[model samples]
Target: MNEDEILARIRDIFQDNFGIEPSKVTPEAHLYEDLDLDSIDAVDLAIKLQEMTGRRIKPEEFKTVRTVGDVIGAVESLLAA
Candidate 1:
């Protein structure tokens, strides 16, 4: 899948799990700071991402993913690999 596809999937996951509106979930929006996602939410999101993408994203990678775009980029890189 492409970046936009990945972004849309992430948006859907965030909205479904956190009740976050898609309008508020911009590429630059930070997961923790902007979305107020707690640690448990982050863990859940990570699992969802792994399940959707079939890639095991490490916990350390989660620390680096600050924004929705960052997550898409990471997933794209893994998909490419």
Candidate 2:
């Protein structure tokens, strides 16, 4: 999928998982600060993303992902590779 499509999917997942409004989710929005996602939510988000994309996203990868766009970019890069 294209970047925009991937981002939209990611946003859907975030909304479903975290109860965050789609309109509030943005490329620069931080999961913790903006969405109020705790550590447990972070773990769940990673696992759900892995299941949805069939990609193995390590814990280390999440450490570098600070925003919704970062997660989308990481997933896209993994799919590309």
Candidate 3:
């Protein structure tokens, strides 16, 4: 899928799992500072992303994700792989 589609799926994941509004899930939004996601929330997000992509999320890769755009990039790379 393309970046927009990946972003949409991530938006849905954020909305469904964290009660975050779709409008708030922008590319520049910081996963922790902007979205109020803690480590546990990050783990939850990774899980949801894994479920969506049907692929296991590597901890090292996930460790580098800090923003919504980063997550989208990670998903894109994961899907491509």
Best by lDDT: 3
What is the C-alpha lDDT profile of model 1 across 1-81, one tens digit per residue? 987888888889989999999889889999999999998998999899889978898888778888898888888877887
Off by over 4 Å in 1: none
Per-residue lDDT over 8-27 for candidate 2, one digit per residue giving the tens place of the 0 to 100 score: 88889888988888888888
lDDT of each: 0.88, 0.85, 0.94
Candidate 2, overall lDDT? 0.85
- The deviation in Å at residue 52 for candidate 3 is 0.8
Rate residue 81 of model 3 by lDDT: 90
Model 3, 1-81: lDDT tens digits are 898988898898999899999999999999999999999999999999999899999999999999999999899888889
lDDT (C-alpha) at residue 40 in model 1: 92
TM per candidate: 0.92, 0.91, 0.96
Residue 40, candidate 1: Cα error in Å is 0.9
In Å, residue 32's CA in model 1 sits off its true spot by: 1.0
Identify the superior model by lDDT, candidate 2 or candidate 3.
Answer: 3
lDDT of 1: 0.88
Q: Model 3, residue 46: what's the lDDT?
A: 94
Candidate number of the best TM-score: 3
TM-score winner between 1 and 2, please give it.
1
Kindly provide the TM-score of model 2 when superposed on the true structure, using C-alpha atoms: 0.91
